[model samples]
Target: MSPAHVLEPTYDTLRRRLLMGAWPAGQRLEAARLAADLGVSITPVRDSLNRLTGERLIVSQPGDGFHVPRLDEAGLRGLLDWHHAIVTMALGRERAGRPDEFQLTGGDLPERSAHLFASLVARARDEELDWAIENAAARLGRFRHHEAAVLAEADKDVGAIERMMDEADSPGLRAAIDYHHDRRRSAVDQLIAASRGGQII
Candidate 1:
């Protein structure tokens, strides 16, 4: 088998760890240590780190090495704002021809939330736009994992969205989306505060 094929599993494993907040933000990811921990060679770890850098989960510097991204209030706000704009555009298209009812499957709250957004984005009928939103959503998922309060509150937001979907209330749906973004912004603020206070290690 090709070396890249052999390393695919290791890459996936590391990606999951990064998304699940296994490492604190700003922590340097040493390839040697990660390979030792994962029982793999450094090659796969390096490859994974480079891939994650492209995804914006981690960044590499000439001398600083690879590290999980750290967001200040402004940076966090910018990310959230970007997410908001893309999702709003998607929702607008969804509202244009919204159905009378909607459905949500059972499972993890975050996964369900993702399904809600994906469903709306799918309505846009633009594959490239959907791809861009999904890509950004994946990157933002890491930030969501960094704050427990955000995840807990996301359940309520998801339910609100579900209700809006069932009623096909476009205005209500927009309002719910706004509320969700507000909560996420607050969560980012709290994370910044905690980090400054040395509470987040």
Candidate 2:
């Protein structure tokens, strides 16, 4: 297979793992170890790591290897704020036309939440905006499971968002989006603490 073919799967697998909080924040990633685990060569692993670093999913030091980023309170809050802003913008654009249909696919709240926001952004049909929202979602993915613990009836909130999307209720959707993000923003400290404690769901 070509190098790109070899690298694509490795990159995707690593990205998924990172987004899913497979490794704890701040833990160093060893290319060799990951290569062995994935049954690939170190070159592909290193290349994948570099790609993730650029995406801000992995942090790279000058002399040190790549590591999973640790989202502190301020950092997490900033991401949430940025995500909410762009999502709000996307919602505005989407409202200009008939909202595009999207299917939510995930077994858990975190995955469902990510898919929900992604669907919202996708409806806007702006590549740049889509990229922005997706990046934020990836960074926020690890902490989403904590939402279940911190926010009451988190699943209900997601269900409501889905319902609004289905009914094309733009105003209610916007309000629900605000409420969802605001609730998470208010509980950032608790979310970060739960993540640090390695509590998933």
The model with the greatest TM-score is 2
What RMSD, rounded to one decimal, does every model reach?
A: 3.3, 2.3
List lDDT for all candidates, in order: 0.72, 0.85
Report the C-alpha lDDT of model 1 over 1-201, residue by residue, as the tens digit: 228765888878887776656776688899999999988888888888888788787889999899987878889888788878877887666546545345677866545766677666766677866777676666666565545553465678878887777544368888998898888786776665444334553
**Each model's TM-score?**
0.82, 0.91
- Residue pairs that clash (backbone atoms under 3 angstroms), model 2: none
What's the CA error at residue 143 for candidate 2, in Å? 0.8
Model 2 per-residue lDDT tens digits across residues 1-201: 329989999999998887777777788999999999999999999999988899999899989889888888899989999999998888777746566676768688888988888888888789999999889998898788668778889899889898788655457888899999888998888877776775534
